[model samples]
Target: MPDPIRDADPTIAAAVESERERQESTLGMIASENHVSEAVLTAQGTALTNKYAEGYPGARYYGGCEHVDEVERTAIERAKSLWGADHVNVQPHSGTQANMGVYFAALEPGETILSLDLTHGGHLSHGHHVNFSGQLYEVEQYEVDPKTGYIDYDALAERARAVDPAMIVSGSSAYPREFDWERIGEIADAVDAFHLADIAHITGLVAAGVHSSPAEHADFVTGSTHKTIRSGRGGIIMCDEAYADDVDSAVFPGSQGGPLMHNVAGKAVGFGEALEPAFEEYASRTVENASALAAVLRDRGLSLVSGGTDKHLVLVDLRESHPDLTGDDAEAALSDVGIVLNKNTVPGETRSPFVTSGIRIGTSALTTRGFGPEEIETVAHHIADVLDAPDDDATLERVSESVDDLCESFPVYG
Candidate 1:
């Protein structure tokens, strides 16, 4: 079949084809990315994109919204079932915006927000000084125990007492360990603060029961639909019914206008797919592959933060094993060989954020492409080979060829 986009606009059509080819050819190891299914892709490209449903289902500001209302209702119901939440709002454009919605609903401007430090695997929306959360609210940060690469709950409790923040944010972008959500919630309660668990990177894992959920522990939970969940590209907020109206209004008239109805349809489709038993198997395999990759990297004498991972990503700190190799250089070398990951700042990062001391690699995309433990171990060796001698032309060419062969063996789309 011919592509309609090619007939309508050749330039954008070429870029889209190139991107699809790129994903098929390369290994996507970025911890925050994954490939959505064809059903989800089709849903996002539907005529629902032309609608403007400015309010909730059955109560929209527009008149011709009956079909979109059904889609939005399905998305909300599936999200609630998937995460066991009492209320869900699937309107925020991104995970960061989801956090904004919570902040707007719960805290007044200039109130304090205590969260994990960015260099220690926290996100920008979790009170990084440059973000709106940091600008509008006074931000206090906590860090992992540098010696053990784990969060110190005792220290966090103490800091919460001192800061007396309005909200406490839990979850991370690159941290390889699971959070003690109940304990964090207890601390938040003790401090009289709302707990916001930003599980942007582990939504599918949580839904699949491969990771502990914060839904029961935190006051609010937020996640990106596109990461491990492989849903549409948007954000979702989950809360108890007590705060449903506040959250809904904050997401609608307070921060954003009409919701992206096409993305909501995609979310509905993807969430429906996730409710199947196969998604649990996929989520379990993703974690297992990540563990295998971690073991191989450690055997190769590479140092992993926290000594290992319980999720889909491993954070490799090069300060000890490869002190001279910066994360930027390692990322470039890996990219040259068709492995796509990102540079990341470690717990005690000394270098700048752009050229950090560590790299974060994930197995979600490869796992989606059907890579198992054996394949993941092989890829781990390739990573070590390139990082061991990043400048060797002969090694680069050999690894590039090997990567091409592997990508051919495990095609993303067929």
Candidate 2:
């Protein structure tokens, strides 16, 4: 093959090599990102990418899909076993597309969709005015309790009743605490609305039984395969058998065209890895590391959403502790020292999304790289030190050195 990528286009090859080096050198704390396993990488890089597997397993719109059909079937079976869903569709191109499939299948244009406010941790696809979900549907938003930094089910129920929404969306991008799926299900039942739980951030945790599954409660469940799942990069939808055909049709003809069979193979590989006992430990330690990080930050006077984390990420509200330091400031300072994460908007955000008042840190990638609570605690201290004196060169140098040492010890790709 003469190393096609390197021999043909050295430009892109260099960029890919540079990205690999970047991942190896820095700490990745982005809540929605993870390092997929080598098996997944190999699978995604296979010849499956050349296949155009349009439509479902047996009934495809394209020819020469037998092997792709097997790969996708394996993915769907693994997903069903992992989430206990009656039907699974591993076809949507991304989580946003998966949400679109559900909406297109179930709701009419201009029907009401009530979801968490974007500034309060909800995703843009849930109904941000700029997204198609918002433009096509009547959107209403709910917020976390300002005092407690948790979803207010009472207020949510009240809103559902007052609005009489057609669907209620649950799940978040930055929330730290676990959702009460059962209660949310009851609320949806009370209002006669469909409950669509987008467990994009917590997919692996739910699969590992570390978090509660929405499969039994929500009418439609959507997730990104890459986030906590360590899959290549794609989306999935799960629902009862009654809605299976509609979901499949919506995903194929309505939202997306050919399914990415290479990614589907990647998902199959990753889902198989998750079925092992070690993945359960990885999921558990991910949560434990987040808890340790939360404690370290809170002890240093930074306010954490919900006081602590019960999942893989922690949301730090920097308003009270560092009045002048915005989330953008913290993100840049941390990035300077090779700790990569994101600036996020906190509940009751006073600043714009671009210059928000909080930072969201995650542990799944670190945990995947063999980091435990002790190493994560050390990382947390480095974060606190950097934030304490962001402008100090001496402090930045010290933390930078520490990050280098940690990266050497963990060795993300070794």
Candidate 3:
């Protein structure tokens, strides 16, 4: 190998190298992010990227897709095995695109859609006004119960009845607790609405059986391949065999063009890795680390949404604990010390989305880097220290030093 990138394009090569260093140096606590294995990285950087696989396996519009077909078929079969769905489509570009495929296949234009409100831990693609789903569909929203920080199923059912929506979306980006998918499905059935569970953030947990599978409860399930699964950057849709063709068509001709065969190959590789027994341990440890982090933060007087976490992440509502400190402030303060996470809006948010009342932290990436509860506890202490004394130079310096040591101990790419 001649190292084509470094030889041909030093600028892009430097940027890529710098990004690798950044990931290797910082702790990735963002709920939606993960560091894929080298196998996945290598798979995604293969010659398949040059192929134009415009359609599904064995039936493509273009030529030269036999190997890519095998890759995609492997991905689909592994996905079906992992999620226990009757049908699976591995072509959607991202979780949002997968949702779009489902909506396009199931709903007419201007039909009503009921989903969780954005400030209440829902995604923008779920029904935010700026998203195409909101612009094309009549949108209604549900919220978390303010006192408990959980979805009020009764209220959601009542609202579903009132709205008479065409589809009801269940799933969230930042919710700390598991969903009652059966209850949501029953509500959708009562309202004659299709149920779409976008389990983008919890895909791996569900796959590993740590979280309940929505495959049996919801009409359609959508997830991102990258998030908790570490299956490269892409999306997937699962449904009954009846809607498979519709979903395939919607994903291909309706929403996107040629599929990314390189990513599909990556998905195949990652899915195989997840099929191993070690992956179950990874998923379990991820949740355990999050719980440990949550306990440490709570002991430090930080208020958590839903009181705690059942999955790989925790949502910290800083309103009561640090009235003057915005989530943005904590995020920036922590980032300055190389602790990376994102600001998020809590239920009944009082500030703009840009300046939220909360921060969302996850253990999936750190878990991928072989972190356990003790390491996560130390990271939690570093987080709390940064947030506790954002303006104190000495404290920041001390936390930065600790973060550097932690990153050195658990090298992300190693």
Candidate 4:
């Protein structure tokens, strides 16, 4: 088969070829990644890339942007329409940069922020000491309820009251349940702080109405255009009209130079797809598959963090199921059989993140590839079956064969 990427960029054709081969050969189960439509891929390589529009449409720093003006405007309007935001900035290169714009627009360099702990599902941009957001700001951490393995709304508010943060952040990377966004909003109000919702992982689901929309309760909502949105790689910050100017400026001269017009075009296409009714079905089914897999795992007496999943990902605690197997080992075992998944830290992880006691499995990709509850169940059983007897190359081979069978039934990237 002829790969379009080959003809498009022969300079990087080898890299593209290798990446496509990897995708075709294995399951991409990472919650944060998704397979965008070929239409999206095409849009991302449009002729709009030749322009250098450093400013907003109609207010550019350079000329020859007449066509790009419509592109930028379309992207802005579609993103705003999809999310119901008073203002939208689809210029950030990625989620982290989108977060940077929010921080720049809303805070002084040394202000304080109270957010969920990174290990507890919070993004690094929320304030891990290693990230720029943490280095420039004071960060207070919150945790999930130990017993429930989910955010403790009450505890969060208590911490907000004590820290008196300049901002309160809500969202998680590995969290399996819906968050109390309204409660977080109330906490921000009580503390007279701005509320920023990092819905990067759930943006698609939220846009499709399968998950709660933070735009209603948050002052600033940041998300990636990919994930559930299944767009290209980029970030968006949606907010009220009150901060639009600051937000736009922060993204342009403040954080990035020229907006990647190709990425913006892809975002526009993705936003359009999200506005479709079928997108809702995709989002819902993604969650359903996650839940189904969690059930099968739990039914086999394996303890799942938070008991089960309410979203498209599950954090399976391995302490009981694979007594001696670290998350790293299980991840390798699954990979050996083409059942790709990432090892992640559970709350109060028993070991380091690199060798944790849990695996984080997400169903957005598999579901998008057309796997439903039945296939998810098959995947769950095969994972448990193989990991139960790790080092059994025979079981790994069998699982790999089954994976290929399911994948063949629903062709990916065809």
Candidate 5:
């Protein structure tokens, strides 16, 4: 039988097929990406996509939303169970939107927000000048300790006290170490500021108890459902029950209109999967694989942020070890060899963000592909080799072939 997509639009079908092949053939090392389970993929493609459940589950604006209401409710309840939050909102379109909702619910425009500096492993949504968070609110940034490549909590608290921000964001995109959520919460409390912990990059780890959770420490917790969680795509927001109405209204009327029901369905399936014992094993191994990768890179003389990782990713600073090599060049070299990651600005960065001095590698997708510590060690060696001799054709060829073999051996899809 002819494929339905191909029959309707050959161009899109071709691109989709190519993308699938690409994902199957290469290593997805992006710290923010993961391969969702088949059940999630199927759920996201269901008839729920046709619904417009503009409001929360039992109180939708639309009439024909009974089924979608169930889906969204299931997603919310499952997320609450996974994170142990007092209230959960599974309707945010993305992590940024989730943040926006929180901000709208809790702060006024022109209010101050203190968060980690972007060049120091922070996310754009955390208050970068280019994002709404910065343009709308007064933003003050803190940085990591230059010598240790870890958040300088002392400095952060000092700055927070000085700025007296309305909200203090505690989470990172490129930080390899776990955050001191309790300490950050205390800092926020000292200033009578709300704490928004954006755990977009480590949602799965926190859910599986592999990393420290901020749900208990922060006033609000936000995360991407797709990252380590392996939910197809979407974001989640959690807050205490006291703030539930404000958060829900902010999400529905303040930030976005109707929720993306299909993605909500995907979140439901993924959250259900995470509740399983096997998902706990997967999350644990993801961190273990990351540690294995870090060990190999350090052994090869690569300078890692924080000197190692306590989560699913490693941030490699190239400035000290390979002063001449830019992160863009290394990223391109690794991509050529079928290892897909991203160029990231490291702590104490001297170069532009586009041409950074560091690269971020992750093991969530590799772990999802069934690659263990031994496999991760091998992949890490290949990465180091490629970075060491990026211009050598022989080296690139050898690493590319090995990457292909590894991808085949550990297929992303069964």
Candidate 6:
């Protein structure tokens, strides 16, 4: 290990050590998070953060930007190469900001827009009344089929045609199926609206060729570097040449001022890492683990939305098998035994979004930690035990032991 940074900044260094201990001890089952390499962490703590390169590479508002320009340019090139995008803007700060930049470039305030319903797996920026997208624009929502628990393209098209929105946002925060990017683009074209695909959760899948790439079909695409990509917390926007200037302007002067060079450097490392041969196998294993986990739940007589998952996440319907348990209770119960997941709404859920009827599980964190299909199934069985008998001391104890044993086999950051 390198020398402890504690010698320089004891305050932050202590916090870092505490976080490291937390990670070493806990099981991370969150769908939206992943562990990054030490190299990525080092890039984030570099001296690049001290500079004020408030503008793009050469066209900076300050001096001493020769080296920082290379960092930003390398990030931009790697992004473009990864997705084959004509234009790449690597300064949005987050996936939400990437979505916002696209929206700001394409739509004016008060314009009608088509987006997915929040409770049905859509992101907050897609049109939640509390989000800026909703506060500034008129939103028309579309929902999935009540029984199928999958995206209803026919209904989405109907709503898009009815609303005649200026833009159509396609993506989700908790959706577990592959997106029909071409169908979404067709709908956007039929309604004469701009289409943006928010592939934040599936960016790694796209990069690794495990899922459909929206960059090839949509007018614009946005993604995050932290999720399945196993990078830092950052956002990126990819667009065609026709919209390059507008998109770049929207990201820079129109939205944020200076880009986070350290984060961008980390993004470059992640992009470089993704291009390696091993990343494809890692991503494929992630999907396989998700499917394997889902199979265990179904075999145990638990209902899974859409029957099962096609990617790295599964939505288990608590209303069916565990009728007495609410999503909130199940989440807390599972957490008690060291398992983690977010409570989410199913298509036909009668409960509110806050107190949802389902829990969303992903295998990204576990897959990155080196768990394969067999291990994933074992963990899934343990999760079922924890959920079915949260109050049983023996059951919780057994499940906790299983979790510890599994993490022990695949120790993180050791």
Q: After superposition, which runs of candidate 4 have C-alpha atoms over 4 Å from their true positions?
A: 1-11
Tens digit of lDDT per residue, candidate 3, span 1-43?
A: 6779999999999999999999989999999999899999999
Candidate 6 CA-lDDT value: 0.87
> lDDT of candidate 3?
0.94
Best by lDDT: 1
Q: Distance (Å) between predicted and true CA of 288, model 6?
A: 0.6
Task: List ranges where model 1 is wrong by over 4 Å.
Answer: none
Over 1-414, each residue of candidate 5 has an lDDT whose tens digit, in order, gives 769999999999999999999999999999999999889999998888888888888898889988888888898889989999989999999999999999999999999999989988899998899999989999999999989988888888999999999999999899999999999999999999999999999999999998999987899999999999998598889999999999999998999999989999999999999999999999999999999999999999999999999999999999989999999999999999999999999988889999999999999999999999999999999999998999999999999999989988988776
Model 4 per-residue lDDT tens digits across residues 1-414? 886767788769998777877777777787888888888999998887887889998899998988888887888898887788889988899999999999999999999999888777778889999999999999999998878897888888899999999999998888889987888999999999999999999999888888889887899999999998898679999999999999998898998999999999999888888788899999999999998999999888788878998888988888877779999999988888888889888888869877988889999988888888998998999988977888887887888998887767766686
User: Which residue pairs in model 2 clash with each other?
Assistant: none
**Residue 22 displacement in candidate 1 (angstroms):** 0.5
Expressed as tens digits, the lDDT of each residue in 9-44 for candidate 2 is: 999999998999999999999999999988999999
Cα displacement (angstroms), candidate 1, residue 372, comes to: 0.3
Q: Ten consecutive residues with minimal summed lDDT in candidate 1?
A: 126-135
Candidate 6 local lDDT, residue 66 = 97
> Model 2, residue 77: what's the lDDT?
98
Scanning candidate 5 in windows of ten residues, the lowest lDDT window is 405-414
Q: Model 3, residue 166: displacement in angstroms?
A: 0.6
Model 1 TM: 0.99
- Looking at model 6, residue 323 earns an lDDT score of 88
lDDT of 6 by residue, 151-259 (tens): 8899899888888999998888888888899999999999899999999999898888899899877999998899998876799999999998888888889989888
Report the number of clashing residue pairs per model: 0, 0, 0, 0, 0, 0
Evaluated at residue 272, the lDDT of candidate 3 is 95
Please provide, for model 1 over 342-413, each residue's C-alpha lDDT reduced to its tens digit, 9 standing for 90 to 100: 999998899999999999999999999999999999999999999999999999999899899999999987
